[model samples]
Target: MTSSDTYQGLAVTTPVSLMFGRFSDAATPLLYARTLKELLAQSGLQKDDVDGLAVSSFSLDPDPAIALSRSLGLSLRWFQDVNLGGASGGIALNRAARAVAAGDADIVACIAADNNLETGFQDLVRDFSVASRDGVYPYGAGGPTSVFALLTKQYMQETGATREDFAALCAGQRENAKTVPHAVFNEPLSPEEYLASRMIAEPLCLYDCVMPVSGAEAFLVMSEERAQALGLSYARVLSSIEAHNTHGDEASPLSGGWATGRDRLFANAGLGPDDIDIIQTYDDYPAVSILQLEELGFLPSGKGASQLATSTHWQQKHNTSGGQLSCGQAGAAGGYLGLVEAIRQLTGQAGAWQRANVRHALVSGYGMVVYDRCLATCATILAAQESL
Candidate 1:
């Protein structure tokens, strides 16, 4: 079905980022608490003011939203525990926006945080799902590297994209990372350096894989009237769409649900790709980002590499926060990174990397790799209030 302006009168504000590191001694709960504290502080809201909370995390197993609410001392009228991995941020925004718009909650806080323990990543992936435990682990393919490697290989064969193409993407993001104070890998990366980087899986090198880090990202969703009464800087949610298990039958999937909902996404937003001033994609890997760029109508299918050279340029219009590629994937926080960055840009909070007159922004998410391919894909368009 097509969509209309379902997200009218919503204000997404108070983007907060915290505790980015290769490892954090703190537990997942502490990370979540710290993030929540900052989210409230930045929004000038008391703890009790937030009656709605949505959380996403891979390490917060056993302790779900109910347990977290008790720990945070929150008596909420609305709550959600998102499990969509990299797509959690957009999904959280989608749900929380509707909640506030429908008066189910006055102000909803969307938060994703994770701790980067010594063996956190490996442990999390070793038994990620039934497909991973049975189909993948038995054959020693315990993590996403092998799966992405296979997809990268197929994507290359189909699109005629080379390592140099992916290198351009990575190299450009490293440049973008320089402007982000919290980014982990801001070191300069040349295409040659990317090509020379050690190969982790066939066709997928060390540089192509995301570095697991500890971090949290959060934002508040409420009505425009509420945001104005608080005198807060906010962005209007123009449109958003999410889907899962698209192209599930393909032996080697190259795309996801983004394409199926692309037309409706733009139509609902009342804008096209050309109207976007900034783009933040879930860059767990360059190739994955490329596919999103293609499927979302930024570039044509099998032609993503062509845009990498220009899109990844310093201070250019793509993955402006350096993405999870250079920013370091902070568990489920990787999903929220783009959303936070987009909100920051729209609110004039992005310091060095802020683009001029960033009236429109696009954020896309892809994640939940089960066995063969990732199942979830989501995208959202946000507009500066003045642009409305």
Candidate 2:
């Protein structure tokens, strides 16, 4: 990992993502500036050192890249505004990483954020569907909550997956969330609790869905050479894949774009399922995780729940940051946030939730398809410095 500056070392000097940064009480101009300033100061990088920007968020509008650059006095060499839904952060990092590695840009900044707590449900519905074309929204699809519910219903019939099984899946996530400090729903919950929660949509109780959480998670990424020059602990960006399920609802029904994409991503990384020590599966709905795991060869098809119910393999604690259900799904940045966690786990910096000797990790991203579904899945293989 530390041979020379001329080589692409296995260590990361620039960030792929930030973890457990925060949920601001409010998104004031001061608060926004403070968040950026804090991260820059935290990393000890000066304003001029920042030369590029990319961002993904649902609530972070009003030209985030420009405003953030202006706030930090950064002269951005390249900038990107990502709107890939749950796949946003992942896409952004992949973009920035490739850009930096190719010498197209250096000192790239990737940010994902949200400022919703007590955010109106109606507003969320309207805003979420905006990603869809007008023709697609009129079906009253609502959001992923409703979309996943229908999928869960169909899945329940196919696998004889009782509502209890789904509850258990989410309940495990909630329990894992208990260990993640920044997870929005960090409180402990039992299966009874998940089942008892009000139904936002059939087969999807309130607990199964992601909530609006406010926080800005930002990463300062520089080329591997610059990172060595600065002396930062980092992981290597091994490989990545992004797949879009352009067929909308029907696509999710037939395939795990998320799951299938993971298969291809790992193949590209030339590592198989066991090679991944820890994982962060985008769980917009719990079934997505089950379906994706099966597709990625981590679990057999139609037996994901059975495997999850009995597996020792994942006992190392996947998504200890509570996945999306616990981790605030910053819509656009949700995917990247998962990628950031892979980085943290690899670097052994994930506090309280740290696992033993995490080297390689898997992270997945799901994007909006339509009618309350996101079959678009992407994955990345990340390795700790030593592993690389």
State the lDDT of candidate 2 residue by residue for 99-217, as single tens digits.
67667677776777655546433455655555553644455655556567778888777876676766767767777767776677778777788878898888788877776555655
- Per-residue alpha-carbon lDDT of candidate 1 for residues 116-215, written as tens digits (9 for 90 to 100): 8898888888889998878876676538888888888999999899888888888888888887988988889998998988998879899999988999
Q: State which candidate has the highest TM-score.
A: 1
Best by lDDT: 1
TM-score (all chains, Cα) for each model: 0.97, 0.86
Clashing pairs in 1: none
Q: What is the C-alpha lDDT of each candidate?
A: 0.86, 0.66
lDDT of 2: 0.66
Q: Output the TM-score of candidate 2.
A: 0.86
Please identify model 2 stretches exceeding 4 Å from their true place: 1-7, 10-25, 28-32, 61-67, 127-142, 246-254, 259-264, 331-333, 369-372
Q: Candidate 1: misplaced stretches above 4 Å?
A: 1-4, 310-315, 331-333
